[model samples]
Target: MLKNLKLTTSIIMLSSLLVLVAGCGSKKANDSKKEISVALNSELSSVDVSLAMDNTSSDVMEQVGEGLYDFTAKGGVKPALSTNKPKATDHGKKYVFNLRKDAKWSNGKPVTAKDFVYSWRRTVDPKTKSPQSYYFDGVKNYQAIANGKKAPSSLGIKANGKYKLEVTLDRAMPYFPSILAVSASFPLYQPYVEKQGKKYGTDAEHTLYNGAFTLKGWNGSNGEWSYVKNKDYWNAKHVQLDKVNVKVYKTEQTMVQQYQAKKIQFTQISGSTVKNLKKDQDLTVRKIPGNQYLVFNVKENKLFANQKVRQALAMAVDSNKLTKHVLQDQSLPATGYVPYGFNNSKTGKDFAKQAGQLVQNNKTKAQKLWAEGLKELGMTSAEFSILSSNTETAKQVDEYLQSQFETTFKNLKVRVAAVPFNSRLSKQNSGDFDTVLSGWTPVYADPTDFLNLLMTNNNNNNGKWSNSEYDQLIKDANDKYALDEQKRWDNMEAANKIAVEQAPIAPLFYISQVYLKDPNLKGMMLGPLGQPYYKDASYK
Candidate 1:
């Protein structure tokens, strides 16, 4: 989701640009007959909401699965299956949602509140082993249920009749609606899922769709798939695109070549290719709310466990050079874990600005720390591999980092282990790598979304960098200051500073997506989390 594997598809929440291809000629607006072909760099891992962990799968899920709420293109929330916004009660710990009876699953069965209840329970059920189960941390009894200490039925969600749903949380979450909008929070038809069992979401046929489109032509192992408009969807009339054909291209060069040939409507390009296409009218760029960072395996790697070593590795990379030369995608050098554009509600100041520069690029300081660390560890030299996705962008970035690390730090041998995207994810999740090129796209707008990943014992903490103070700061932000907006913001700022000072993960750059887009494609929406929504898109 780089919002989870939001990579351009990733394991620690990476974000990728949406690449579409369509006919070159001008067309009528809202052309219902029009269809567009697109490209992905990786294959979809799964469509099952509970099981999907990568950005590719999450992208597909976003198209085919309708949640209680949907993110608007303008970075706001809108009711989808729910009749309206839920009414919060019980001092903001309880929520009541009334469903729209018109909502239906792909099977033509009504989408009732029970479906939501079941979906939440299934995610937190230990038997499901959902990687996303930790998303329900504040939901009452969720942790116990996930830990196998309580029954899934005891989770604080219940269906009131067939249309109304009630949710009780252990603590108030002001951004709960954003959480609900995530694909992992989308409902699944119990009967259908049970019937499909392990086969569910393995392919298009085994899965069900209820959003703007239905997944088709995907066999779980193929490099291509289709999103066909769902006639049975409650809002089907609003979905203008008739079909979207998706294919996977292993390199940006191939995607750009397809764009140049007028065979595709959209594609993302990076590095020197972006410079080459700077004069092209079709070139479009937008800043996405995501960060690419270096993850250190502190739990297992003796060399990285030392804070000085981690700090040295982080400071060695010149983010400005990396983004300007190596990336050349206009991605901003990260100020900290949280990227730019997200603002404090009270002061309207950018969070990154308020936090100030936490990790600085200083070769002198890096060398000093490296020497101190080596001495402390009783080692003259160290060697380890940097694991990263085999995408062209990742390869280039890691290669640059390898050069930077090796040349800056004496006696440090950094090997680049470039594997397929999914394989890299597996190694990260299993804590199998020495250091990893990881990234995160916020699932929600709040700073907590990015900060939550590094907290001790977090499911997404692949590096297992733990600090009691850092954990406390995050906990206080979510729990003690949950109702106090200013306090929450302050605590999160503190936590961000703490994470940066410790340098378990080196915040490299804030992702700025560069795309080659056809001007004909109109009304295509990008969610706040960086995934594109094509429900409103049509060729013009």
Candidate 2:
């Protein structure tokens, strides 16, 4: 989700190496007549929309499940399962939707408005413990249900009949429709979900599909999967490819080898690999709105609780050098928490530019801060490890930070704790990390999408860093000044500044993903967040 419209902040556990290319030799022999193969850097963990915390699962969900609204290529919102744009009433606090009668799940069951209501309730149900529960904070009673103060059935969404749905919000959110466009907001067939129970979404057979394609060959832990055209989908006629095969290749060199051998049509490459492929006609360089940041475990790790320590670590690494030398791609050094050009002022100035630079590389300042922090903790030296995904890019990036921190702070010892993408997310969620390299892909385009995550007791605030003023500023942006565009901008700008200045989470960079795709592979929509959708893709 990276379009100007409803962007969802689904956690990207690992940045995927998305690549597509025309193949020759053995790769061509195994594929179906109208199929293409691509690559993923990590495992496809889950298909359950409510439980999908990673971008890979979210990407798959977008193709297998239909949401009420979908993002248009021109950054507008368009109806997906719904018949037309939702009719807003009650001062934009309520919405009415009419469903398409022709839509059907892969199992041949008719899709009804009830599916939306059930899906929403399931996400906010405390028992479900969905990672996406916080995404519905704007829905009436959603917060109470998520907090266990109310039942999920009390959530303010209802099926008026077989084909009509109505939703009420706690307050008017102009971007609520954008939320509806995300995979987290997709409908689920309640009967099938209940029938499979714990086994639902564990594999292709256990999951239901209602979008452009149905997932196949995935057995939950497998490294390979396929997206086959969904004949039951209402808009199947526009879906071109018969199938899109995806396989996981952990190393950049291996991915490049696969691309060179024509075994995979798409693959992500970086560093020297990108330089070598820069002249390729099918190479694509895309700058995304997502951000990679360092999350400090301030609650459990007292070392990070000291503002000076956090600041020291944040400042030690030269982001400019890291992006230019270590990353070796189009990734930009982060100026602040929000990425550049992500949001614009009423007059069209970018939010990141308006906030100005709050973080900088200062070896002297970092040294001073480290000394002061050590003295504050009554210690001469300290040791900590950085947690990161084991993906090729993450390993290289974390290795660089480890060297920078150790070299800059002579008294401090730093270690790199590299784990699989799923393990990293689990550790981050359980606060089982010292400091983790975390990434966020906005579910929507607004700054609140990122700022909201750091607020006091926010579900996604794995670091447990809290500030009352920061919380108030974000609240004012979404509540007090929501109706006033200029005032809302002011609140968000203030909040962003506070987050960076505090250094509880050190903003890193915005990814400029480089990949290869065959010139004949057309119709793929690379969303604003840099994840490509292959439903409309076809081989020429």
lDDT of each: 0.80, 0.79
Q: What is the lDDT for 415 in model 2? A: 87
lDDT by residue for model 2 (145-191), tens: 87779999999999999999999998787778777877788889999
How does model 2 fare in lDDT? 0.79
Regions more than 4 Å wrong, model 2: 2-26, 29-33
Supply the TM-score for candidate 2. 0.94
Worst 10 residues of 1 by lDDT: 2-11
TM-score of 1: 0.92
